[model samples]
Target: MHGQTTFLNWNKERIALERIKSLDPIAHGYMDTPYYVAYSGGKDSDVLRILFELSGVKYDLVHNHTTVDAPETVHYVRSIPGVIISKPEITMWDLIVKKRMPPTRIVRYCCTELKERGGQDRFVATGVRWAESVGRKAKRNSLEIISPRMKDKIVLNADNDESRRMFETCSLQGKRVLNPIIDWTDDDVWEFLRYYGCRSNPLYGCGFKRIGCIGCPMAQDHERLRVFGRYPQYRAIYIHAFNRMLAARRADGLPTDWQTEQQVFDWWVHSTRRRREVEDQIRLSEVAI
Candidate 1:
């Protein structure tokens, strides 16, 4: 009988380096910019940043401030050398009041505004892995041409076909992505980060599995509750935002079941009764020709 252990030593690093080197021209041609590495102060992103350095590739490390990011995360992001921190004009609190609705799982406008706005019309590198989510595996590929919305995405799974024609189209049409670590597993990420001597974010030391915005809608209920427990101030701030949002809705003459900020908070985290309330309001706002 032949016995072999699952090898942690994979050629993924070499593959990633090759991808970085090969995609350099296309990235520059797309926007005359070096690859924009989206650094979110997470382990995966840290690994990618190190990999970019190892490849000696021309890339800029960029971090977008969500305002609601954990203090540890903000400090960690700022600590990274040469990382450009992009601050949004409006904060999460003001955004809620302006949108007149709290960002939910289905309607995550906060992510669109804070996180996804960067690297537009440019070739970007991300640490997104299929191991993170099933949706990522389906939606992302080695080379991708991403539209603002989901419908027009062109994802090419083949790294072998580094054809200039497709890249030219991506440059002309929408943002292009070069995701070298798309297939890496969680273990792969940790192994690479450790190998590169990157300690990663301080939150990880506190037994936090995922590092993201304090109250990101996409996080699980338990994770959200954990964040609220850890940072009680955020809960108060969100409630205040909700209060202003309710006022805005009332001024616009939009009827709602929630009157108090606590009630909105309850609905935001737990209540399923008025789940469609925000969507209904959005539908009503759409002008019919």
Candidate 2:
């Protein structure tokens, strides 16, 4: 069944490629116009980069550095040829300090600062899929809006919900945004990677289910645990940030919940415990060997 599915998917992808190629002449007529590929050094973005290259389109590769990205992911991006890295003028640490708390799903200032605003191009491409996040699933395939502050400025918007929202916000300010890979699925992404021999961040090989910010709240418990155990320094930084948040809350005379500190600590400790379990399993296997 898996093989049959792969075959069907590949055929569909070839058809899609033909359609894209058919539109290439029109797209290339605007060669003088700038397009940016938002590269995250993740598997998805890697696949997108390959697609852009294969399409024979001219585009600048733009990587947004969140400042809290996993070391492996950062290294992977830098290793790519001709990749341009943009760091946010504001650091996550600064944002957390200013906001006095870590970003949650409800309040994600990180995406605005770290990902969206960091892109240098007016038209951006991203390897965003609807299957990845709920927010992404709701976004339009293509749209144009004015930059947030400048009424006359237009930017093409693409990518997923987060990218769309970023474009919309920029449009409100008078910027345009564009997303070319909004319709691709996870399977399509992996297939592209496999077909193109594209390289992805090592973090994925190290058992990270999703690669974004080190302590992204969107991650599952097991993913966070894997991060905590595999990257102790990062885990410590998160704990320190959480501790600071707790202290700041107290200083502000905010009511404390017993679960706040416990929850953060548990998240850290639970990963450590899982790591130990894995080590034990390995040792047991060694004994049998």
> Which candidate leads the pack in TM-score?
1
Stretches of candidate 2 above 4 Å error? 1-33, 133-138, 143-175, 246-289
- Candidate 1 structure quality by residue, lDDT tens digits, 1-289: 1123332645988888877887785344645778888999999898789888888768889999999999999999989999999999899999999998999888889998988778887788888888888888778787888876667778775367555356654534567888889888888887777666678899999999999998887777778888999999999999999999999999999889997999999878753335556667778788542
209-283 in candidate 2: lDDT tens per residue?
678787665566667666667778877776677777777877888776635654756644455456668999999
Clashes of 1: 0
* TM-score for candidate 1, residues paired by index: 0.87
lDDT for each candidate structure = 0.82, 0.64
Steric clashes per prediction: 0, 27
Give the TM-score of each candidate.
0.87, 0.69
